[model samples]
Target: MFCYQCEQTDRTNGQPGCASAKGNCGKDATTADLQDLLVHALKGIGQYAALARGLGESDREADRFILFGLFTTLTNVNFDAARFTAFLREAATTRNRVKARCDELAQARGTTIQPLSDAAAWQPGASLPELLAQASTVGIQEGLKKLGEDVIGLRALVLYGLKGVAAYAHHARVLGYESEEVYAGVETTLDFLARHPTDVNALLSHALELGQLNLKVMELLDAANTGRFGIPQPTSVRMTPVAGKAILVSGHDLGDLHALLEATKGTGVQVYTHGEMLPAHGYPTLKAYEHLAGNYGGAWQEQHSDFAKFPGPILMTSNCIIEPLPLYRQRIFTTGPVGWPGVRHLADHDFTTLIQAAKALPGFRETASDESITVGFGHDAVLGVAGKVVDAVKAGKIRHFFLIGGCDGAAPGRNYYTEFAQQAPDDTVVMTLGCNKYRFNRHQFGDIEGIPRLLDLGQCNDSYSAIRIATALATAFGCGVNDLPLSLVISWFEQKAAAVLLTLLALGIRNIRLGPTLPAFLTPNALDILVKQFGIQPLGDARTDLAMALAPRAA
Candidate 1:
């Protein structure tokens, strides 16, 4: 098996991918191959489903399936091959379901409609062996002879970017947000790939278009989250756990967290947010839970150690779930797109089993001493204090603004983000989003004019807050966003971050400093295109980058 979708992908021996029995992320070959096949099958489904949409026939369930199915294939999300095998059958069934609807619609309208022969009519074997055999024809390497590595690289970029779109869209979707435009974009892009276009420029253009599409998805998600949970407010959350039967909810799904919270109410099971769920504490509807305790851990990468030590059951709601250790594997439960082979899987928003396990175990024996972290400074919160921020900037009390955002990973180079934030001058305000803020967010930076020097903007999905704040700041100064003192120092570890980057680029934002490392799928030529066209730069010395960003611009 070969896979290279995340920032931690192996590049050893002059190779660009993980081609071994196990991926660098601990994904076994069986799981990795099945993920690739799942991707292949999704595209096959898209080929037909996209045609149906074009004929004015669309299935909401099929569109939603595309979102969840592709999200499971993302790096560090799902490792259960059984899940992918099931997804393959689901993809085939959904494709046929949409295909039939489109056919009936076209016949009534007397419009001749044709579907792609390969994806529409393709069939994979029912058993594991047959599915494995079918996977051989549907991998990226299968087209290397005809498409070449360069074209394949661009295709992978588009596919990975699309995966990010799906993830954000799914998060919004679960909260009752739906967009026909976004759904059409997903299927339309997948169908484009099915047609096998090899032009380098076309592929790159298509990729940026997906980036444009991601912007829409992110906006919808921002609205869904705020509309339901209420705009995140500036709230300090306790890092120490309280004594009780506790349930730790991780991953990016607020919907799942809300469900678990409601189910565990009055059960003597206290809920604590972990990883990406930490910001949920700032939402009034979620934090209103009498037993909803504070956060219990840091980034998603630290789950193994964190989960082992926590004396309660854990529930993972979405991405970046590493392989669970045996110590807490039995107590760990996955729901809604997260799965591990041996870990118990919960579905249909059920948390009874998890709550039961939590009650059976000892929670925090004693409440730890109080220590807290501030989060939930989403756009509304920040913009609420906008007048003060603008005044401080005008008076030169605030030197510049640094927007450090994106997913956090375990890579050594990620420390650059820590040092970058640490070194920002006292006169400058540093705004951070996503889990990457964990690296240095705990560092104490006092406020200027009643505004904390370091502002936390919720999760990676809350990037809309950052964008809105930037646009508002630019408007206040009567200048373009790029003309402002803001600079984006982003650390990308997954496809969701990639989608955010494309959104920034498509908006004509320039000079984004991206790291811990470049995508393995971006060939030298593709990288050059981004560097030249978008003014994108690789992360250099954090100190040097900081100095460069703070330098004066010419009139």
Candidate 2:
């Protein structure tokens, strides 16, 4: 498949990508090629749409499609080759329709314009076989030898960051938030890429610009989440399953989870959050559901064992879906942009069939022992106690703040995050977010003064919360964010985490630690640029890194 998009990419000495028949993420070559064609189709649209905008014509429909289409191609989001083919054909139609409109406007103005560009002029094949042939010229590795691996890597970085932006924007749109700026940003970057500039500096700038756009989208999503459901507050969630009919919902979409909660209310189908949805309990509106039981599993990587062990049906609401075992494959369902070849998908926010299936299956037969973990320490919650936090730091009760968080996975190197959290000095506060926290979120780190040493700050997308807290702490301490006694030890596994890393680098945040192993897509040259520009470093010994972070700032 030749895919190096996620953290689990093959890292052999000669080839640092999955170039075999199947990708490390289980994506087959046919599906990977189709996805490449879909993106190429999107770039074609951008090529024409950018020209169309110059003629005082714009396409809002094309803009929205660009976001939604790229979102479907993100890692572990969609694996159906049929869907990729449909999107490719649909993108061609969307581009041509927009071009036709622009032409009409030009004709009405009594103006003759130059002929359509090569990208806009090209047409897709009429049938599946023809489309398959067309995909060969536009694959991700189309010009790797000519352009050099560094340029290809930089392009992939910008494109993948854009994918992350689309995923977050899609979530916000589902909750009734939309922005023309985000659309413009996506179109502009795609248009830039279509023109084929190979300047390393220019490509790096594009990456950081995508990072800035990602920040805006993250803010929109944050508003959508906190506004729809009240701001997240500190709450203890039950880790043990409750006795009743149960349905486990995983992924990052709060709106989908909310719909499922509303649909199953009073029907005696007890709903439980899993994976990324574990943070739902902190929201006042979601917590109001009496049947919304505790979380059932650990991170997304453990889904095979976790989902199989659960007695009831399982619903995947977003990214990071593993192939379910035969024991529970039929019982697993998908919604939103997430999909699988055979899994039943729920659309229109309706969960009637799913609820029925839940009732039909054997649920938790008896209550498990009581166990709970604290969550919901979102931006508002942390800032709510900013005064106490500041006072503790000034009094030397809290020596440092460790922002150890990111996407969690099943790799052996992932244990480093757990160890890092466990070994943080007793005087430091170990704050976390995303599924990675599942490693040690249950561990007792004790509190510094009145603040809990382990503070869970929602999901992967909640990096906004961490940013807000860091900025506020910097403001409170009368120093820059880097000058504060805080360190960001990010554990990345996918594109969303990649986008967040770019955001930090774009903001000039320095000395950040990223692990378990760098992205395989990062060529040595591109990696050098990041390490030099941002003072970024790969993870080393936790104890050693901890000492460096604890060292006093230069006067």
Candidate 3:
């Protein structure tokens, strides 16, 4: 099996990807192969679903299944080969249902459907070995001999961007926010990929179009979250644990956390947020629970130590799950698209077993001293002070703005973000989102004219908030977003971050710095296209990059 979907992929012997028995993320060969086949199956569904939609017959189930199936194949989301095997069969069934509907629609209209691609008609194998054999033909390198590395890399870029869009759309979907436009965009993009187009310009166009689709999905998600939980407000959250029987919920799913909070309402179980769930505390409805305790850990990369030490059961609601160690394996549960072969998974928002496990475990023995940090500087909170912010800029009190954040990983070179945020001049305000903010959030940056220097804008799922805030600032100053005194320093580890990057490029935002490392899937030519088109640059020394961002030309 070969996979290079994430930043941490093995790069042995000048190779660009992991081709060994296990990847750097701990996904074994078998699971990686299964994920490949699952993607192939989803493309088959897309081929039929796209045609059906054109015939004026759309299957909502097929649309939702396509989004969810692609999400499961994202980096570190699902590693259970058996789960993916089942998903393959489900994909076939879902495709067949859509195919039949398409046929019926054509019959009613007396028009013949166009000839379909192989992906639309391919059959799944009956057993695991047969599936593995089939996977070999559809893997990432399948087009290398015919399409060359550059075209293949561009395809990977489009596919990975779609994976990010699917993940975000799925999160909003679970909260009952549905968009027909989003469904159509996803279906057509997958269908385009199924055709195996090799033109570099076409692939780049599709990538930017996917970016626009991602922007819409982000907006829908923002609405879903704010509609359900109300707009996030500035609130300080405890970083230390409180003494009680406790349950820790991680990932970016606020819906799951709300369910657990309601379930444990009167049970003496204290619920704590972890990873990206830290921003849930800013929501009025979620924070209203008296027993809803504060956050328990840092980023997802540190979960091994964090989960092991937390004296309670843990729940992962989405991506960035690693192989669980024995110490906390029994108490950790997974939901939604995340899976590990032996880990217990909670389905349909049921937390009975999870709550029971929390009750049996020893929670924090004594209350720790109050240690806290403030969150909830989303668009609403930030823009509410737009008048003051603009005034400060005119008065020459605020010099620049830095949007420094993205997914964090355990890989080397990530320390650049920490040092960069730490060394940022006091005159600049740093706005951050995603788990990467954990790098320097605890540091006291003070404030300028009563506005906090560091603003935490929810999870990676809340990137829309960052975009909204930036656009608002530009509007207030009577300039384009690129003219605003803001610089984006993003650290990406997986697909969702890829989608966010595409959104930025689609909006014509330029001169953004991205690292710890560039994605291995991008060939040099492909990377050059991004560089020339979007002015994307790799991160350099923290001091040098900061100085460059603050240069007079940049201003």
TM-scores, all models, native as reference = 0.98, 0.97, 0.99
- Give per-residue CA lDDT, model 3, range 527-555, as digits (tens): 89889988899999999999999898723
Give me the candidate number with maximum lDDT. Answer: 3
Shift of residue 328 alpha carbon in model 3, Å? 0.9
Report every candidate's CA lDDT. 0.88, 0.86, 0.92
Q: For candidate 3, what is the lDDT?
A: 0.92
Model 1 residue 243 lDDT score: 85
Q: How much does candidate 2 score in TM-score? A: 0.97
Tell me the spans in candidate 3 whose CA falls farther than 4 Å from its real position: none
**Tens digits of lDDT, candidate 2, 1-555:** 467889888776486887888888888888887887787778778776776787777787888788788888888888888877778878989998987887797798888767644566657778777777777776666758678789889998988888888888888888988887787777787878777778989999989988898899899999999989989989999999878899999989999989988999889989898888889999999999998888989889889999889999999987998777898999999998888899899999888889989999989899989999999999999999999999999999999999999999877688788888999999999889999999898898888878999999999878899999999999999999988889999998888888898888888899889988888889889889888888878998877877888888777
- Best model per TM-score: 3
Q: How large an RMSD does model 3 have?
A: 0.9
RMSD of each: 1.2, 1.5, 0.9
Quote the positional error of residue 87 for candidate 1 in Å: 1.1
Decide which is better by lDDT, 2 or 3: 3
Candidate 2, poorest ten consecutive residues by summed lDDT: 113-122
| lDDT of candidate 1 over 220-285, digit per residue (tens) | 999999899887888889999888789899999999998888898788888999988999999989
